[model samples]
Target: MMRLIFAAMSGALFGAGLLISGMTDPARVQGWLDIFGDWDPTLGFVMAGAILPMAVAWRIAARRAVSFTGRALPTPPNPVIDRNLVTGAVLFGLGWGIAGLCPGPAMASLGFGGLPFAVFFLSMAAGMILFGLWNRR
Candidate 1:
């Protein structure tokens, strides 16, 4: 019960952070990615702000045997740099560059962002499903 509550709170906080940081705005994201024309450094600053706390959290996590919720700690990331990894990164970058909304911000944007976001979410879901089917084969 406590773990569930904490999870919900964490999610809420994350969503709130994204909203406050202008991360939920696709235009802001697109502006940041537009390095050649009217480039905005807001996203870079946001990334830097996010990285600080995450780095501290990771350091703490590394010292822990299990999470505060009593779950086993997640394994460290694999060091491999394979074709699939590169391909996925490229695909994700392409999508992000085109749409200007990442998975987290896209989902977070759904509440305030009407029909457009709904369509984006639906399309994103379809892509995920297609990828899963392809990967399964």
Candidate 2:
């Protein structure tokens, strides 16, 4: 189907962009986050490049009924700043700063990253599962 094909292409493009932009490198991510000590600006350019396309897509989304893939656009989440959101954000930032591996980049780096990546991915998955169970209870 066209939807599946488009989804695959989009994912491929996203992975390629992450690879080409050096986003797959944990060092680069850590370096960017290290604003005080030896900061890297390449990540900024990569983020800017990504934002441009997404900005246009958002504008288009606002005007459209169904997505280009023929699915209805999903409703945006409520923009409220609650305790859980704050806690989760802080936890996410801490994990990213310590591990230098956010979800997307971590998955992308799995092959080259070897044991450390495997451990991180497994731990991340376990944490997600635990959180899901906890939230459900």
Candidate 3:
């Protein structure tokens, strides 16, 4: 119950950050990717804003064996640039470039009640389910 509560609180905070940072705007994200044309630099600032705190969090987590909730802390991600990593990065970039909404922003955008966001979210979910099925084989 406490884990669920913490998860909900974390998610609410993340969604609120996305909203406050204007990351919920697809056009803004699309503009940020438009380097050859009129590129927006705001996303860089947002990225920096996210990365700095996360770096500090990583440092803190590295020194801790368990979270405040008494659960074991997750290990840091592997740094290897393997085929799966490359392929996933390419696919994620393609999706973000085409739709201007990656999974996080796409999920957040659903609160606005638009057909496009709904379609994207449903398709993304289907892809995730398919990938899980495929991965288990």
Candidate 4:
């Protein structure tokens, strides 16, 4: 019950932050990415603000034994950077450039009801599914 409530609260907070930071709009994100053109540094500040709290929390978690629950926190194993990672990054960049929406913000923007976002989201989901299937083989 506590875990469920925590998850819901975390999601609500994340969505609220995205909305407050104007990250729910693809145009805003695109403007930030367009450094050569009329660049916007607002996203950088928002990202920094978000990461600062996360960094502190990570440090605390590192020092702690177990969280509020008795279960031990699992640390993620470091992944090797390989050709697949590079290729995936390039593809992600290309998609972001073309659509101006990444997975998180894209989902958040769905509240605004639009065809372009729907197309982008569906396409992104399909791509993810394809990647999962391919990786499984």
Best candidate according to lDDT: 1
What digit string (tens of lDDT, one per residue) describes model 3 on residues 1-137?
Answer: 99999999999999988988878888999999999999999999999999999999989889999998899998778788899989999999998888888888888889894999899999999999999999999
* Best-first order by TM-score: 1, 3, 2, 4
Q: What lDDT is obtained when candidate 1 is compared to the true structure?
A: 0.92
Off by over 4 Å in 2: none
lDDT of 2 by residue, 34-137 (tens): 99999999999998999999999989999999997679997986988999999999999999999888898778777777999899999999999999999998
Clashes of each: 0, 0, 0, 0
lDDT of 1 by residue, 17-114 (tens): 99999888989999999999999899898999999999999999999999987899889899999999999999999989898899999899998899
Candidate with better lDDT, 3 vs 4 = 3
Instruction: Please write out the lDDT profile of model 4 over residues 37-127, one tens digit for every residue.
Output: 9999999999999999988988888888888766687676568889988998999988887777888888887878489888888999999
TM-score of 2: 0.92
Best by TM-score: 1
Model 1: clashing residue pairs?
Answer: none
User: What's the lDDT for residue 100 in model 2?
Assistant: 82
In order, what lDDT does every prediction score?
0.92, 0.89, 0.90, 0.86
Model 3 gets an lDDT of 0.90
Off by over 4 Å in 3: none
Off by over 4 Å in 1: none
